[model samples]
Target chain A: MEINHTVIDSVPILAVSGRIDATTSRDLENALNGLIEEDNNRIIVDLAGVEYISSVGLRVMLAALKKVRPKQGDLMLASLQPFVREVFEITGFTKLFLICPDQREAISKMKTG
Target chain B: MMGINREITVPARLGEIPAISDFIYEVMSACGFDAKKIMEMQLAAEEACTNISNYAYEERNGQIHITAAAEDDLHLTLEDWGTPFDPTSRIAPVTESPAEERPIGGLGIYLIKNCVDEIHYQHRDGKNILKLVKNKD
Candidate 1:
């Protein structure tokens, strides 16, 4: 997966693309870990470019969420493709984290709340 | 419109997952499976292969063979000559539990079970064979 890191209104947005499966999930894990350490755990993963995500990806996101929540920060998701969104829904990831419809809404959630 | 059969064997490693998924998608789609069904099978195949890649061989190198046969229903079988483990026996995770209370992993088989109509496991001839089928109706 390709992750483009950008700061919008100081909220870090990781625009990820391609497939996040067993092999590529480690890269995502590292990126999230680095952001958690550098950006105070306030992060938004912009998945508009991502078309597929497997359980391995979900595991990474769940781990990151657990890490950031205790620090009073949150990891939000934005603009999921239908396939990826369905994976989240089937696996119950829809409840564990805050999933926004788009980047603007995710940034808005991070900024206002 | 269903007499398609395909088989491929690749190293049981994380890097080989894409190749496996590609083969599965092509075979499943050609069998007249819908995009949604193909995606689900791909996910299930990935989960099974991931388990094989990570835990099946256990610090050793082996191969996982995948066979797809489209008859009345789309049937897929994954055979691995690795550690003998009944992956289907794992209990499903309690998804209703709060995130923090839930464990970090163990969703592999649960997701696999959800993707297909039926799953059967057998350990015979020094191979762990997992067969999954999705009806064509």
Candidate 2:
């Protein structure tokens, strides 16, 4: 997966594209780790561009959530494609993270709540 | 196994995932399988390939061989040269607990087993071979 990060009003937003399967999970783990340490632990991951995800990718996301949760911080997801959303729902991560239908709503939730 | 009915070899990397899935599904579909069957087979094949990429190779780079055949039924096999790990041997997904309470890794492999007709595993000569079959009849 290819990751690009931008700070929207000091909140780190990571835009990930391509597939996050076995080989690319580490890149995602590193990217999230960097943001969680540098920032105050709140993160918004834009998954609209990501096409596919496997269990390994799911583990990385779980690790990120586990890291940020203790700090009273969160990792939210935005705009998942159908296939990507299916994996999240199947894994029960849909309830754990704040998943919004669109990026606008996700960022808004992060800002307001 | 040199003259197997059909076989494919790919790097044990995420980049080759789609290619591997596509090839396996196409061959299965050509054997008169419906879309639902094709999808189930593809997902199972994909999960196995992903496992090999993640657990088998560790820090080292390696290759995973995928072989397919459409005799009376369709069969897909994934072979890797890395660690000796059997995904099927892992603990089953916790069916009693809710999704949030259950662990993350085993669900994919469990799903693979549920989808296919036959699930087989073996480690021979330092190669881990996994075969998933779906009967056409």
Candidate 3:
């Protein structure tokens, strides 16, 4: 997996590509942890390029969410492909995170909070 | 039985998951599963294989052998010589639980159960065999 980091209105946006499974989830966890440790609490993950995710991937996201929420920060997800989106839906994660149709919307939501 | 059959064995390690997934995707695609069904089958197979890679071999090195066949439905069997475990026996997580109360583990098997049409587990000859079947129609 590859993650490209950028800042949108001070919120870190991670544009992730490739698959996120048991083997690749650590890369994502490390990226997100680095951002969290840097005090970049508000974050956005762009999944437009991600083709697959398993429970391991979901665990990383959930851990990040738990870490950030306490600080009044948020981790948002955007541009989820149909299959990826379905994983979230089936796991009931759609109710937990602010998932947007695109980066602009996700960033907009982050800005409001 | 369908005429198509393919089998592969890979080291029971996390790094090998993609290769396993690719194999499943190729076979399932040839079996006439659409993109969505293919993705679901891939996810289910990956979950089962990941469990084997993580827990089956303990600290010792081991390998997982997978066989896939298709007729009216797609069938995948994962065999490993790891510790005996039944994934079907694990209870499903509470999907309605709040995120804070949710547990990290257990979602893998839950996903496998939900994505595939049927799953069967057996242990014989010191091998843990997991079979997953999904309808192509």
User: Which run of 10 residues does model 1 chain A get worst, by summed lDDT?
Assistant: A34-43
Candidate 2 - CAPRI tier?
acceptable
Q: Can you write out model 3's per-residue Cα lDDT over B5-120, one digit (the tens) per residue?
A: 99999988878888988898888877778888888988998888777866677646899999988878988999999999788887466657763453333677878888999999
Off by over 4 Å in 2: B1-5, B10-43, B50-63, B70-74, B80-86, B94-105, B114-118, B121-129, B134-137
The C-alpha lDDT values of all candidates are: 0.85, 0.78, 0.87
lDDT of 3 at B49: 79
Question: What is candidate 1's lDDT per residue for A1-113, written digit by digit as tens?
Answer: 79899999989889999999988999999999998877568899999998878888998999999899999899999999999998887778898889999999999999988
Tens digits of per-residue lDDT for model 1 on B1-137? 63998999999888898998899888877777788888888889998888776777874799999999996688899999998878777736655865334332257777787788999999999999999898867
Clashes of each: 0, 0, 0
DockQ of all models, two decimals each: 0.64, 0.27, 0.65
Two-chain DockQ for model 3: 0.65
Order of candidate numbers by DockQ, starting with the best: 3, 1, 2
Residue B66's lDDT in candidate 1: 91
What is candidate 2's DockQ? Answer: 0.27
Ranking of all predicted structures according to TM-score, beginning with the best and ending with the worst: 3, 1, 2
